[model samples]
Target chain A: MITLRQLQCFAAVAECLHFRRAAERINISQPALSAQISQLEESLGVLLLERTRRRVLLTPIGRDLAERANDILKSVSDLEEFAHGARTPLSGTLRLGVLRTLGPYLLPHFLPEMRRRHPDLKLYLREDPDDRLLDELTSGQLDLILMASAPRNDDHLTVVPLFREPLWAVLPLGHRLAAKDSLAQADLAGESLILLEFGDGLREPVLALCHAAGSREHADFRATSLDSLRQMVATGLGATCLPALYVDAEALADEQIVVRPFDAPAPARSIDLVWRRTSARSPEFRLFAELVASHLPTVVTPL
Target chain B: MITLRQLQCFAAVAECLHFRRAAERINISQPALSAQISQLEESLGVLLLERTRRRVLLTPIGRDLAERANDILKSVSDLEEFAHGARTPLSGTLRLGVLRTLGPYLLPHFLPEMRRRHPDLKLYLREDPDDRLLDELTSGQLDLILMASAPRNDDHLTVVPLFREPLWAVLPLGHRLAAKDSLAQADLAGESLILLEFGDGLREPVLALCHAAGSREHADFRATSLDSLRQMVATGLGATCLPALYVDAEALADEQIVVRPFDAPAPARSIDLVWRRTSARSPEFRLFAELVASHLPTVVTPL
Candidate 1:
């Protein structure tokens, strides 16, 4: 049988992929970490790492077990968190993973409600793309993930529908298209559309609508953030699409930008609150999701 | 800050959801297990399990951590397996996950080769759906998975394409369609197709082709395995589609069954060997995949 201490040592080495660095990360001496790894290998009757004069590398099995070891370690931490949450019930720290596109625009609306409802709770937020959010959630780095729709890979997680927010066509205030009462797909024909760089969850959907509208992506420029895109469009750089929530929360303040909805049926992103299926705080998370949904501006339709 | 013993205790209880049964599983006394769990909760400052007078239930966090504990335990075992395999390459036990549709036919051809090449190697085979195989692979329950195509949720896994096996139309001897040199999509019009029940990865592809051919699935009776489907077709029950490799491996001796390919641009299933991204056995598994590809009959095209 393998011990947790051995696994912890193995995981630290696997992550850093270097014994000395891994030892440093765990605040253990290099020789101590090295000994633990060697002992682990001897007990398991297999060589997990390849040690040379200058470098260390995991054997194939070492690589395989490294991930499992991380998962295991994360689980141990999660068990502690579960117990803590149950005893205090939202009194401790809650790590939340948010998408960059939604973070700045949405957090302001819900944080107040959360603080008021659970005054003892401490909220820590990290923003990234959908993929990174899901990855962190799986590794127990984040207690819950708030993102656009539930991810396709929800095999081990539960996703609660929060709300649906429609998209808007963003243009320079003085642009001819901006004068239109409502934007039509045909209005974008032969135009070059601006969009955020790759890895933004909004990229695909916007590109699809761009293609459907006979417009092509702006090959030269990709904005790093929604604010950058709005700035570029304000200067007539190119037209782009943004979710309605962003416009309501952030864009309206910029008088140089014009935002409009497409005809009756617009492409909208469904926001969801997702957490591990086995999380001990299902009821709490569910309740939080409901509270967040209720707090969302009426412009954003709650699911 | 939790110890391995505490995790072991929590995991056993989570698995059985009963203190007594969990203790029995771990060869510890019920009171000991209970004490460990309580200590774990106290140390973590959270509650993991909700114990009622009548039953044991995992709190949401308990369920979540249970999965992590299982992964942790599996990782430890994997470390040993990894070490053992490294000391005597391919000599120790290799747990392989195979799809139900492909296993019976595919294994016979390669098992002998595996034995001849690595005499001391012990192969432990498991047959399951593609999703489950991938899930187990992620959780460290399986070292390698042989299945059709790469799974969609393979961000953390490595998939090496092995071969492409075209599908075959199965018919009873003397059936009107058997006389044709080759089958066509229209030939299947109005026919009732027999398919393995849901979760068999092959079902979706077959159903798509069936729908394209103006045919419908046999709703009344669903066969559990390819052999059963072959038997049904052989008895003049109904016609079905199968991968060419299956026919070569299992149906060659069945005189009552007639198998034929499509006219052109036939639909084929790509077989691949999948393993965790962190697995150290890439070179070895890749070599095995190549060996299996080479051993595959001419009917299956090696990648």
Candidate 2:
């Protein structure tokens, strides 16, 4: 027979432990709250509060019951908020699954704006290679994934188009190609190109681009995190590729790596957000996605 | 607006994915349970269960709601059981307070039987010097206290009688008094009696009984645990006093010790059950107490 109104009234009184203060806070009349308390106690057949004019005491049993009431009320509140959020914008916990190659380029620009617009939003950013984030999102662990589209069909989610960002080639600071404004893919055919390890987001794209350019294979070095790849490139150990936004930052502190735009067919990668249509995404999630999409492209435009 | 009952119905339906099974388990008619779910949905202005004639599937948001529902239900169930068991007699947790002296003598025999009779009951036994349980009882932490009574006023709890057991004088198994039929307080004069350290529950009574016999400055040793005192007495050491039940078995265990009743106004420690006036000493706690007291006198029956 307990209603949300009753629970709200009870919770206020139980927490404040003062009838007048609880009533004042809840914007209800003190006499009404008192009458309601009397009615509630009579219905439950237990005394919840031992009140004196100047003191309030909780019976041993009352203390136990209050703890349960608090948990119940909180659960119900989450349910209501979640249900409402599902119909509007994406909200709650939005696990943004990202591709490693795209992550450093996109996140630094969009996250701050997303925070300003969607204050209730929480983003769990996971950067991996290829379509790995999409697979996790499909299995219900990760909520949404942002990655380059693959040739294989994705049955799990509805992929929405974001934007494509161009890729560039990186060489050591004193490399022979450092003085060039831009270079064709075949320009570095004789040199070994260091590759990232498996599941590296750009592994397939670079391989396909090279295969089309009539190269059998290039000298290969594999690295995982971006900093490691940058370290290899800075020491003139190998040539690797990068998204322009990553290298466009002021000047490289190492001053040894020369990053140049790709001149052949202007290689670019598609970035998209894939989420399970069968999964609950709150309104806050939608606002965050929109905010990121709006701010990210402008930030990447200078590149 | 969702009651605990409605949430129960919803959870059952969600988990079992069957209305008939859930309704039967809850002891409600199928139609009635379905109506409650419909009502819950209408109240929340959201669809919680996705139902088709052939199957019932949770909506994406409904899946999230179900997890929250379970948490709320579990807490609510614990609270309801706690509240209803208040006067139901040891149905759940019983916070038992015992004097340090009484615990060794009483717990060994009682705990095993209590466990057999009330498998679900949880006994939190606390042993302290005096009636510290009484303070806990008043503060709503403890349900009962097994302690020796003083002529002090207790406003919150009524006392129930526990068994009264006699005391015995402990000495080396083959000491001179080992063959005596019985000993008087006067016989203890000029003989040093080892006592428990200060703050022991039996100290006051033992000191009073010894002083009545004009046995002054006769202290030999002081101990903490009764076991320590008994071990000291077994080593051809000075005498230490103990309740009849403890040495009733130990006397037979060793030929070096003797068991004889004290004849001159032997000091008696009355063990009583102290419970808060508002205590919900469930049925099991009361039954368990009776089981304990009934077995006390037999621990050291007069031989």
Best by lDDT: 1
| Worst window of 10 by summed lDDT in candidate 1 chain B | B52-61
Give every candidate's TM-score on chain A. 0.70, 0.70
lDDT of each structure? 0.80, 0.68
For A122-160, candidate 2 gives per-residue lDDT tens digits of 677787665576567655557667777643365545666
Clashes of 1: 15
The positional error of residue A123 in candidate 1, measured at the CA in angstroms, is 1.0
**Per-candidate iRMSD:** 9.8, 5.7
The deviation in Å at residue A163 for candidate 1 is 1.3
lDDT of 1 by residue, A139-224 (tens): 66787889886775756789988888877889887777888888887788878889887655688778888878899899999899
| Tens digit per residue, CA lDDT, model 1, B17-105 | 78898899999999999899998777876667766555666654556566766776666566566556556666655679999988887
Candidate 2: tens digits of C-alpha lDDT, residues B122-177? 77788876645666666656667887763247655667767665678777867777
Q: What TM-score quantifies how close candidate 2 is to the native fold?
A: 0.55
Hey, what RMSD does candidate 2 come out at? 9.5
